[model samples]
Structure formats: structure tokens, C-alpha cells
Target: MSGLGDLVARLLGRSRAPVVVEDPPPTAEQIADAVRDVEARIEGRVPAAVTARVHRITGTVEDMVPRLDRFGVGDRQAYTVVATATSYLPEAVEGYLRLPRDFADRRVVSRGKTSLMLLCDQLDLLAVTLEKISDAVYRADAQALVAHGQFLADTFGQSSLDHPGPGAP
Candidate 1:
């Protein structure tokens, strides 16, 4: 049993630990191009409502790159913060769109919708976070961050407690 557990742990750990490749930080030109590409991709693939939502969230993210300096992200730690905050929304949206409709399995349909709803909620939250950060930087007030954080916490209140039950999904 111990040997089996150790082997399983190593397998899971190895799969999770991706090899690190230190790429250069994105330039203004590269980021602008990337944003354009994402917008174009969204326009072609998703419905108008989803396209609007993606644009709303990603527009704020693009705005953040320039204002990161305005927001005091100009130090050595700037790279880490910027890179960490960069959106991975395009991939998530593409994945969701690609997920097959599975009406046959009633459970799968609900589970799938639950996941999709979470993705949209997450993007909305990301937009709010970026907005709060920009506002905090503009005012040079740490309290704004605290207030937004409180709001986020309140908004997320016991997420598991509110999981879309069956038909609700």
C-alpha cells in the first residue's frame, strides 16, 4: 500500500509540475497584438452576448498594462505581479465553447453549465479586480483595495453552498 501511494504521488506531482521556461516579458507592441487577436477570435466564435462580456473584461485587462505603472507596479516585483494578473480567459472561453453538448446524461449537462457559469463569473470578478486596482493606484489609497476585497469576499460567500442544483444549471 505504501509503495502504491508513493508511486501515485510521484506521478501526480510530476504531471502537475510543468517545466519552467523563462520567456521575455511582453512588450507594448506584443501585448497590443495579443489583445487584438483575442478580440478577433471572440468575435468570430462566441455569441454576441458572450463576445460583449469577453470584450468588457479583456478591455480592462489591456488598460491595466499601461496603468500598472500609474498604480505603483513599477518596482522589481512588477514583472511577477503583471504576469500573474494577466488574463487566461481566451483559453477558458475557447475550451467552454468546444465542450460538447451532452443532453443524454442529465448530470453532465448540469455539471457542464455549472462550470461555464463559474467561468463567466470569474471573468466578471477579474474585471472588477482590475478596476479596483486602478482606482486604488489613482487615489494612492490602500483602503479602496480593502473595500473591494471585502466586496469580493462577500460576493463569493461560501461558493460551494450555492452550487447550481440540477435544474438550476
Candidate 2:
């Protein structure tokens, strides 16, 4: 039995399996673009109401800065409200929320250790939002959208990872 186990282990270890460090799943921009493409392909198949709601929600967020900034809270807190409110919107709204900003080219990519830290910060914000939101369905959707946005922002470009910093990809 020991010999057999050893043989199996050796075989497994020796197998030159392509060491695939799956480059962290396609960034959110990638996913959002795919979703939009599918929506476009389907054309009128997706409900008009859903599309309308998504547009409306995005419009609301686009104009939210004044109200959010007026409260004297930090960007993270303001983002929290944005994330939560987005959850209540329709799925289409949630889908569109994943779209990357037009200015992704401006972000600076941190290599190695710095990249790791920024990645950790992104994950922490995601976890925190999940824990804070009460509604399960909404929570899940919001987290997904938030994660997508973070990825898109990162892919596009981010100036800062800390408080009062520019938004994440």
C-alpha cells in the first residue's frame, strides 16, 4: 500500500501539468463588456422595464455626488450607499453597474507587493459590504456589482487605494 501510494504521488507530482495560475478571473470590465454584448445581441429580448430601470439607477448614481459629498462622509462611505442602493434596482441596473469607467487608462498598476496590498484592500471592502448589507439577495448582487466596479476601476486606472482616493476599477 505504501509503495502504491508513493507511486501515485510520484506520478502526480511528476506530471508536467501546465501550472495555470489562472490570471485572476477576467477583470470586471471584461465581464461587463460581455454582458453588454449579450444584451445587445438579444436586442429586444430583455425587458424594456429592466433596461429603463438600469438606466435610471445609473443616472441617479451619476448625480449622487452632490448629495453624497454634502454629508461630509468619506468616499468609502459614499460608495457604501451607492452599492446598497444599487442592489434594490433591477438586474439590468446591476448588470450595467459593472461597466468600467471610460478613464481606466489613467490608473497606475502596482507590481508585486504593492499589487498584493491593493488587491487585499479591494477584497476587504468587498467583505465589509457583504457583512453590512442585511438583505441576502440584495447583498449578493451589490457585492457582485461592487466587485465588478473595483476590477474595472483597477483595470482602467486608479490614483489611490486609500481614503479620499480615486475610485477603484
Candidate 3:
């Protein structure tokens, strides 16, 4: 039966396993460039609120690139950084920008909120999420620092407390 199935697949020019082609995950530099492009795309085109939130998100993204190793290439945070740069942030801004300013800011699109209001909410969410990622990265680094400090103290039997100031006897 297995041989018959393989014969049928071969006759149809197919394979036993479906081919899956997934794009390689974006690198830190690619993510950085993408976020920068998003920022540039929205510059002077959006209101102050949108611009401010974008800045907040971009700033965290910039800070996160140097520490991306904390999350590793395949981590969710890494995916998020890439998505925010390549898709999420750009889509949100462009969706709003595509609307006429007066209509976007004035017309209630959903939940009794205008497009501008909705965009602000989206931007705020992105900013907070990126901030949380940044905090997590730093927290990991801080833990590593503490461990290294403890290792030094244990190995040397000395700590900064053991060193006296110049005025000490």
C-alpha cells in the first residue's frame, strides 16, 4: 500500500512530505532598520500623540537590539521586535494615515472612538509591550551581573566593602 501511494505521488509530481518554506527570522540590524523606516514613514505626518507613542516604541526597540541575545533569535520577544518593526507598527500608522485627517480624527470608527483615538491606543499597547521586553532583558542582565559579582567575591574572599577609603586608618 505504501509503495502504491508513493507511485501515485510520483505520477502526480508530488512528494510524500509537503515542502514548507519559512522566511529566516529578521536580524537585529534588520529589525533596527525596519523600525527606523517606520519612524521615518510617520514623521511629521501624524499628530503629536501618535508621534510621541511611536518615539517611545522606537526608543525601546533601539535599546533592545544590543540586548536581543537575552531573548535569543527564536524567542517570542525577538519575533515581536521584528513584527513591530516590519508589520505591526507600520500597518497601524499607515492605516490611520491613509484616512483624511479631519475624518480620521473626527469620525467615530468604533467603540465610540475616532480613528485617531484608536491609533493612540494601539501605539500605547505596542509601547508598553516593548517596554516590558526591555525590562525583562535588563533584569536578566542584572541577574547575571549579580551572579558574576558573587563569584568574584567567593573566589577572591574580598568585596568592595573590604576596601577602605583614603581617610580610613
Candidate 4:
């Protein structure tokens, strides 16, 4: 409703609570952009290990964006990619960035690993997982190519010349 309508309603004792409209979840492209933004914001602010892993994750996510349809909506891989960008990656970096650099990088916090080590481990995990997801996304295309090749070979008939004996000259 317009501001005037709201005022009139309030004056007439018909005041209602303001309606809250939630934004829809971001598209795949937006998620990828968010990852890139995270990478940009954290460059040189975090350890080189962290920065490198962030780049790897961002690149993998961008590659997967083109084949997201293979995952369909709400698939776990899709959800993971989105969450890794919007939540997981940012949270890990921010948590590390919030700490004093000396303590984060030197003092062991747990399992004999400093905050930097822990964050690197986490980022490495994220990078590997995203790479796997990207591979799975493209595997569909690879399978299609194989299937088409088989269809062509079968339809055209494979000649003996196509596969000679192991001892043949």
C-alpha cells in the first residue's frame, strides 16, 4: 500500500503490521558472483593458502554454473555450491579475519594447528568438494558424447579394419 493509504488506515484505527517481503534465493550466477566477491574481499587479507583455495573454489563454482541444470533445483550438490559461496566460505574467512593475525597464524588452537592451518584445511576441503561437483556436472556431457559415438558406430557398422588383431601389421 501507498504511504497515504497506510496513514489513512492508521487514522481510521485500521492499522496493520507492515508486511515483510522476503527476497527469493539468489540464482546460480548470483551465487558464483558472491564467491568471486568473497575472493576479492579476502585477497591479501588472509594467508596465501586461503587465497589460493578461494580462487580454486570460485573457479570450480563458475565452471559448474553452466551445467547446473544437470543437478535440477534443490539437489544437494546445487545446495552445497550455493551454501559454500554464501555461507561456508565467507564464514570461514571472516572468522579467521576477525582474529589477530599473529595468534591466528602462529599459536596452535587445536590439534596442534593454528587458526590459519585450520582455515586452510577447511578451504582445501571446500576446494576438493567443489572440484568433485564440477566433475560430476560435466560427466553428463561426457556420457552423452560416449553414447552418441556408440550410436554412430553401431548404425554405420564397425569394420574389421577399425580394430585389427594385436599381431596384425
- The lDDT of each candidate is 0.59, 0.44, 0.87, 0.86
TM-score of each: 0.52, 0.25, 0.83, 0.75
Cα error of candidate 3 at position 48, Å: 1.0
For candidate 1, the per-residue lDDT at 85 reads 39
Tens digits of per-residue lDDT for model 2 on 2-64?
777767866888633455664543333443344444345435533454444334334434444
lDDT of 1 by residue, 60-166 (tens): 65766675554343453334325423446656565666664242212244546554565566666655665666565556557778888889889987567668777
By TM-score, the best candidate is: 3
Displacement of the residue 23 alpha carbon in candidate 4, Å = 4.6
**Residues forming the 10-long window of minimal summed lDDT in candidate 2:** 97-106
Best candidate according to lDDT:
3
Residue 12 of candidate 3: its Cα lDDT? 89
Candidate 4 displacement at residue 57 in angstroms: 0.9
TM-score ranking, best first: 3, 4, 1, 2
- Root-mean-square deviation (CA) per prediction: 20.1, 22.7, 4.7, 8.2
User: If ranked by lDDT, best first, what sequence of candidates would result?
Assistant: 3, 4, 1, 2
Model 3 residue pairs with clashes: none
lDDT, candidate 3, 1-169, per-residue tens: 9899988997888868676899877788888898899888888888898999998988888888877776655789877876888899989998998999999999998999999999999999999998888888888889999999999878988666789978899
Q: At residue 128, what lDDT does model 3 achieve?
A: 92
